[model samples]
Target: MRWLMLLFCLGLAACQPRPVKELPAVSASQSVAELYRLEREHHALSALADVTVTRQGKRWSVTQGVVIERPLRLRVDAINFLGQTLFQMGIDGPLLQAYVPAEKKFYTGMATLDNVQRFTGLPLALPDLVACLLYSLPPGVVESAQIIETAQGVDLVLAPGVRYETVFSSGRLSGFRYRIDDLTLYEVAFGPVSAELDFPRRIELDVPQSDTRVVIALDDIELNPVLSRQQFQLSLPATAEEVPLNEMEPVDDQTVEH
Candidate 1:
């Protein structure tokens, strides 16, 4: 299996955004507690959203009209640059399926309930994988975090390596900022945590190496809409070919989603 280190920002040191005014210093223990509460808050919500993924590359890059159903399914309706859905993935509990419409590719695999836990670093799963790309390690994400007043509302700045910073108001994750190495907010996911990630107003990815930037702006989103099993079922055309999991290229991102 040739697993491509899809986008691991491993070599870089700890990343930070331009810092704002400092708040009272929070003890590591308190930070951890706050982060845990936020995780619980995040997982409890369900939503449906339209997402766009942009990769700074020449051959293929931008993707739009991606859909995500909280705590499960993800559908890639279209991709730009490639100009088609290069891949689609869905998760129903532990069962995961990925489809490549362009290659007529289909795959089925087992995913543990704790897949996200074990895959805290650079592991991207269906549905939530997109979110992970924006911020790695959800449940145990915050080694330490502090609730501080930002220009907007309270923002949580997690300590340690990641350049992940989030803004929340009324317990909903309103905005987020993340970077890989020197990358400028390479990934961003936004929406009310009470609902699924359907309201991603903007998404951008800049790959300086490729000298390209991909941006996706979302205007409308639907949440928890009834969907048929067929929507998530990985049914391939009779002529569709099979792509083994071992054969499929791996997307490696040390920070989860680079």
Candidate 2:
């Protein structure tokens, strides 16, 4: 009888499930540079997007083409549904220029953050703009960082208020969220990875602060394509009046309500 009881206990133990091992916690000791390196890395890209801009309770929809080269070179063109060019803007490190055909005006100034904000209505510097568009972190000194591991993936809090959450699937970065002080600054969700480019075929950007959202349903996307310097150049008509970017009025409610 004792032997029978021992055999029954052994059979029960054999049928019991084994303990599941927990995944190792994500390391927080990664340096800022190392973390940035792990994020999206791209040299140059050209994309066409359907952009929707909302400001002061008004929304404007337009088709935009963007070409970007690393460090600080970008060109953007906005076109209306009528196939008319609304505006063309470019920045090459230091020089910034924009041509508004509707206003028949040309603007030029130093490619400073304030100037870029005045022209583009986006309060981001050249590098930040590029990073935002490319779904990556901007190149800057990170004051501090904290790593939070989640079932979805990991969230890296940088500096005082910026937090970047990277969603992982199959051990790959599938999406990202950029937040400032708990407010979502931007969110990007990528479509399937393209075999030719090894990047997402579609990318979406949502900016809540400015009430702006852009969906780049990439009909065609190229990575590191051969591009000429002239592609980043914009020429205005000789008769076009040049205006200073600083002199532009605020597009938000901060402007005087006359």
Computed on alpha carbons, the lDDT of every model, listed in order, comes to 0.44, 0.68
Q: How many clashes show up per model?
A: 5, 0
lDDT of 1 by residue, 1-258 (tens): 223342334323235355787543444334435445554433321222233222333222233344444455544443435455555555566676666565576766655333331222212344435444222234334544544555433344554344555544444444455544455433344433424552335444443443434444454444335666566556766877865454544443321121
Relative to the unseen true structure, what is the C-alpha lDDT of residue 239 in candidate 1, on a scale of 0 to 100? Answer: 71
Output the TM-score of candidate 1.
0.49
Pairs of residues at least 3 apart in sequence or in different chains that clash in candidate 1: 6-252, 46-196, 47-196, 49-198, 133-257
The candidate that wins on TM-score is: 2
Each candidate structure's TM-score, on Cα atoms with residue i matched to residue i, is 0.49, 0.72
Candidate 2 has which clashing residue pairs, if any?
Answer: none
lDDT of 2 at 104: 82
lDDT of 2: 0.68
